[model samples]
Target chain A: MQNEMVAMLLAGGKGTRLFALTKKVAKPAVYYGGKYRIIDFPLSNAAHSGITRVGVLTQYESVALNNYIGNGSHWGIDGNNSVAGILPPRQTDEGASWYQGTADAIYQNLDFLDNQNPEYVLILSGDHIYKMNYAKMLAYHKEHKADLTVAVLNVSLEEASRFGIMNVNDDYSIYEFEEKPKNPKSTLASMGIYIFTYKTLRDALVKDAKNPDSEHDFGKNIIPDLLAKKKRLFAYTFEGYWKDVGTIASLWEANMDLLDPSDPLRLYKDDDFRILSEDARDLPQFIGKNASVKKSIVNQGAIVLGDVSSSVIFKGAIIEEGATVKDSVIMPGAHVSSGAYINHCIVADNVFIDGSRRENEDGKEVILISK
Target chain B: MPHILGLANLHGAPKLGPITERRSIASTSFLGRYAFVDFTLSNFSNSGIDQMGILVEEKLRSLVRHIGNGVVYNANTKRGFCSIMYNEQYAPAPAYNNDINNLIENHWVLDQSNADYIIFAPCHLLYRMDYRDAIKYHIQKKASVTMIYMKCSDGKNSFINMDELKLDENGRVLEIQKNKGAKKNINVSLETYIISRSKLEEFLEFAKDTSHFFSIRDVLSYMTGQLFIHSYEYQGYLRAFTSVEDYYDFSLEFLNPKVLNELFVPEWPIYTRTNDTPPVRYGEEAKVSNSFVANGSIIEGSVKGSIIGRSVIIEKGAKIENCIVMSDAHIGANAKLKNCIIDRYAQVLHCNDLKGDPKKPLIVRERDIV
Candidate 1:
């Protein structure tokens, strides 16, 4: 399976719905579950699925993302056979530009995909939080000889219209794909994950680039074009925890899922899944005296001095004495001053909450943007 | 002893007390301020010997979860920080033992940096001492290996014997006897040693041809007559907790303010991965005296002469004396705990009476109830 598939991660989305959290860094670089970034889910899933060669697409401020994922050495993506790299736009015959859409981004970086010459191309969005074995999806795609396989996750009818709804036949063949249709056909939603045959993707991208009317997106242009051509696309149903962390409330809720003392999206339990990032020094996490944490996820390099309940505290965050944090997402280097109370808040890195302030009371969620 | 590479072998050892239940040493073990492995890594980092590797055989989830990037020990740098070298294939055959040398070679490769001096220290031993001074002493004496030694007064089972110690006029070790028995023992090896990088490379080459079961002590014993194997004396508090009693005794030593200060004062800060818990909140009726309470604790009860961990809650009217409460534990109201090491997430119900002797601290593992 070496070099059989190469992954192209679409991490450049502005994620405007995430609000103030994505104000400083790219949406893919948003800190999730204390120690991990939002992009880690896709990168880890891709690596675990035997897709060693990966290229991350970034347009927004990718400094933190680049620093966090330096050369992809942490996920065993070094050496000759395996390589993970960040593919930013460069000057070419097509001219240098930011990624307008997912399909346009892939069309611009066709040279990078062509160099690897993988049999299959696995494209994924970087902002979703879930643990999936993409190898299983790849196996299904291979068995069915699909030109494109879309990872379809089941959602309730209410949430179906929010995603790219997929209408599948009895045999799991995707009959139609609709992007946020008011009148949806089915409850199976495309997770924005597509596995395309290398030739098929390249041809589709080239054709899409020439079409002036196309919006240059997989759901908006490429999938519709593929459907018009009667392409062989199947849906790989996923029955697991999957959440699109597009909004502040959703991101907060996704983090809160980890604190559920029962089953959670267990990224740490999956040995096959590997989070590819720059390796930090491996030191044991320090748990301070007088800390009263329950069902909280804390990363290394965090210094806790107060009470924390059902929260996700990122690496290097400091919760000073007499502070109370509940149902919140505190990023790295964030300081909650003494006697302050933070509830249902998403605090960014390097943010300092003033003493004794309860800003997010009355359940009014706020994303504290770093200055 | 010649220069030797030390593997903590945390997975291989039989742990008693709170350590046995924990996958790795809990981050909130030391009075909820630091992880148990902090003492070992800090000593190595402060010594300026950057080439270090940790061998993890089992319970890797906790180990990986805790040691993310090794930044606490200042090992997170452009140069070699630390690598968790795991054997990829587990082919259960006699020939697999032949690959031990390959594993050692990989360890050497991981530690291949611009460092000149090499030392191996394990996490099982707890002692706060500057190893740089010892390394400096070794270089000045022109010794091939300098093993740190402590004089044990108690007549207990010792791992290394130094009865044949021959010291010069300047108190430098001339020779150390390995197998000799005596009434009064002067030198006992602490298993920590310094060796030149080149000498370690040569030793690796020698071990490649020898039996697969070759121990580090075997190499040390081999170079006894050819090279100058000296000893560096360590006089401060040094205790090896291989047994249950040893761990229990070492834990209770924190009750005394002097011992606690000795371990923490003078700016010898033990660095570990810090958590993001809030400051300990004492309820209106909380009464704490002569105890060390870590951050994120909610103390509504009476805690005296005890060390409580992060996120622990002693409900109203509960009395804890001379106990080590790990993180996320809950002591119900009116419960009495004495001389116990409560593991993480343990819940002592209301009015429960738990007590144990100092030699044998009451052990409650994670998620347990009394």
Candidate 2:
């Protein structure tokens, strides 16, 4: 059966800014909120958008991420008529090579895509924390009858230079594209999400792969080349909670956003649009007698016996008595012993702090604690 | 694998007041996310007993909704099966309905599995026991039936009205009688039995001939001395929900780490159906202590020594202590509650000060709007 649309999630980035969190795992597998991984956002969005076929492109530190996306059964995009496979760079008959760039990753998996023979291919990034239905974007793409569509988020003009800015016409048609230009013409920034007609994407990737000067990336090569050739490129404006949690501070902020009731991503209020993930099946979280938890998102299997404020506590993490955790993110199985004061920090998984104090006195910096 | 079959006997479960009024004890909510039958089914799954049957007596709709396909318990869909055997023949007759009758009515389960041994475990009793160990012990003893029991230190208070087995020097069951709270330390039956297929069939015939209302426990109690009965002593955690007080006490007792660790072992996982609930969120004023809080709960109040279930909402100024608030329950602002078993979806809006003694917890009916 030919699928209407297929999602190819780029989960290959190492995210050196995440430092120790991505040292042993890919950026997509980094822990988010209290019980979810960063990759769950796009995968769950695809599931909610009625996209059953998906291919996750993995590269650097891909073992843990590959294990987590096991056939995508947790996201309900596996088995039956659905297809969810992890596409890693393999030793093909031609040769063996690492994923050169975003576009190259998808290009290598063309055979996997051809099997489904989808009408349109949805390109996604494993970064960012948001809940969006790509089906609506696909509907917009169909109405415009465009050869390519890029999801753009409105950003302030001052921060526009940091992103790949899209200079579009009045009808949301892209007239010019700039990659971190010194002088910006528009505040519309690419969110690294795209929808392409299969033939158009395939032709562009095949041509780009032969060019020696090209970086084989979507933003650097394909989008610009498409514009140079006068192809139909439209921008779909997405007004939702979208945060690129590339750094330690942003990752901590994204977790803290979930605790705010008025936040755009109200995880507690959004019952219909649930973000499903694999069940940890741990025991319920226990708050000890002396514990005082306020403005926090705590997962099951966590044991809190101290004072916590404005934090995200993962499952199996422990906060011993007299320990103080303020404005921090505790990964799964991490422990904060008594007398340990943690503030403005991201404690890695299973990292134990034995009665030690780790706090930026001025609260100006976010510390990354790892084994 | 010696074709062993497990029967989650819910016929002998005692009434748990308003909580059990609309649902069977097997489907009763526990801790936060699990049902009482989850413990039994998980034990069967952990013991590698794939072929299992849940013998439900009444209020089977809720039970069926929780145990759909039994896949959560890791029951294989292809080779293994989890069957829900309900006795529709004696549905109208409450007195005549028993585990023995349910088994006889659903004889296809027995004929289909061709099981060599049948393990009967009650739902009301919460514990983790590997039936493989008991089966091995039963084979070693060469006994016709093996009864699982625990040496309870608080028998005078807990495990009341439950069967107490008097074992002889040779580990033979001399007598099976109810614990009348006469002693503090006593051997209490967990209502878990391992009987061979032939012996089970013989007992079923005897039960049918003696009385229509005779349960498997009653048949076993009568033929204790005549049959070669051996007792297997379980040293782990065990709790029997005989009454409302027992349920409240046992549920709150899990707040203690020492008691909680006994049954919640890492190696022996108790699986339940997964819900798509987010993590538990705490508001700015939330002050919790010594509580078991489940996922999707939004707490802005002060909770101490409580078990809050999934998606529960506790508003600001609401002070709850020593309570078992089930899933989707709401405690209104400034409402104070202590020693209460707030049922699922119950709203304590107008009730400001609902209090009860430690010995007795006030019951708020499920979905009640106070």
Candidate 3:
């Protein structure tokens, strides 16, 4: 079957900065926003954009991520005409090998893409928290007749050097691509999203695989190599709430944004733009007679009997009476006993916190409880 | 080991005043997020009874929509089916519509199922049980029909308008009498019957020749002494919804953790259709106590002793006490609502004080803009 576009989600990153939360699971499978995983954002965005096929490449701690993305029906990407598949490293005529890098991951799955025969390929990172329509970017790439288009977000000048800077011309045509330059030339930073003509991407991947000295990375090798060859590269500016939840602090901040009334990332939308996830089959949240919750988000299966403020509580979490939670993110199945107080912390799944074993840190740092 | 087919019979459901005006009692919203039928359907699925049929008496639109494809209930798409059977010919005639007649109307369910026994249950009386153990007891006793009942100590106040059974020493039901709330301790019938398929065919034929108005309950009452009928005691959480007052009181009783824990088991999970919605967001001014809040709700007010459904918005300064607000309801700012039942998509705006008596709670109809 011939498809206009197919999304290839890169979900194999081992988020070490998230600490013990990603010790057993991949970065994409980390719990986020009470009821969803981080990968749900990109998968839901692809589905909402009407992309029919998706191939997710998994490497580090891929079992959970692979299981969660089975057939992609949770995002409504599985049906008679549409397909969602998990592509892992496999043994071939050459030999058994793991995915080397971002470019190498797609290079290894060229046979799978050839089977779908898609004209355009959308490369997505599964760890970011954002909502963008890839179809609009694809339309822009087609209209400009460019070989490649990278989604860019206008960051502040000070933060520009922290990201891969895209130096573009007046017409948004990219002239140079720098990976975290000391003296940044532009505020337009690459959002790690890219769309390319299938033939162009496939040829570049084959050439990159042949180079022994190449790092086989997308931002480091392929993108710069394409720019050095003077290929048509353009920047598609995306103006929305985007967050790279690469660290514990960033993940906590992203969760806190959901509780903010004026936050731009509105999850309580009434339209078709909804972030879909797996159903945990939980009952409605129950708040006890003594509970007081403010500026917080609580999901189903949670039973709250304490004072909660500025927090995000996931499914099956419990806060007993006399326990106070403030400025925290309680993952699924975590329990806080009575007389315990938690502040500015990220309680991992299944962790039990009590008064005697409480972790009371200053508001300056975010405490992580995985035990 | 008999091949049993489950039937969720909605014919005996009582009219719950305005709450059930547009929908059947089977489809009535319960506990903020589930329909009354979800409990019965979940029972079948959890009990490993794959083939089941829902006999709809009336008001089927909401029920049909809620049980779409029956996928949430783990219904088998190929072999076993979750069929919603409605009698179109006699649907307009309530007196002529009964489970016995509906079975005869949709005879394909009985004809196609390769089963030796059929379990008929009700939606109005919500409970959780594995019918496999009940079937084993029925088969071992060699009873022609098995009736499930519970021992109610508070019979005077609860289980009103339901059936009470008079049993013999051998656990045989001597008589099926209606509960008039005359006794404090009595055996209340749950209206769940397990009958052999051949015997079910005979009862259908008997009711057809008796009268068009004769329901299956009447048939069971008539043949109580003649058939080898037995009663099986079910000891668990069970609530009967016979009137609007009963619905109001029983729903509030679940606020107690002890009572709620008896119904919600960890291993035996109750399944319902899931709306992929975000978690409930409570604003800075929110104060909630003793409430069940579903997902996608935005609360900026004070809610005490209430059940808030999905996507409901409670604006700042609004006070909701002892109310049942359904999905997509909007309570405007400073609106004070007490002892009210707001239906789905209803907006209680510009009405500062809308209170009702605790005995008879007020109901705002579906999609009503007040």
Which of the numbered candidates is closest to the native, going by highest DockQ?
A: 3
Q: lDDT tens digits, residues B1-370, model 3?
A: 6687999999968888888989998888888888998899889888988888999999889998999988777656567778899999999987899888899999999998998999999998988898999999999999999999999999897787689999988889999998898999989998999999999999988988988787878988999879999989999999888888788888888888898989988978888887898899999999999999999899999999999999999999999999999999999999999999999999999789999899999989899999
Per candidate, native contacts kept equal 0.00, 0.91, 0.94
lDDT of candidate 2 over B248-269, digit per residue (tens): 9899888888999898899889
Minimal lDDT window, size 10, model 2 chain B: B71-80
lDDT of model 3 at position B233: 93
**TM-score computed on alpha carbons, candidate 1:** 0.67
DockQ of each: 0.08, 0.86, 0.89
Residue A37, candidate 1: alpha-carbon lDDT: 76
Instruction: Show model 2 residue runs off by greater than 4 Å.
Output: B75-77, B112-114, B153-155, B183-185, B205-211
| Predicted model 2 interface RMSD | 0.7
Relative to the true structure, candidate 3 has a C-alpha RMSD (angstroms) of 1.6
* All candidates: interface RMSD: 9.5, 0.7, 0.6
User: Chain A only: TM-score of every candidate?
Assistant: 0.95, 0.98, 0.98
DockQ of 1: 0.08
A-chain TM-score in candidate 1?
0.95
Question: What's model 1's lDDT at A181?
Answer: 78
Better of 1 and 2 by lDDT: 2
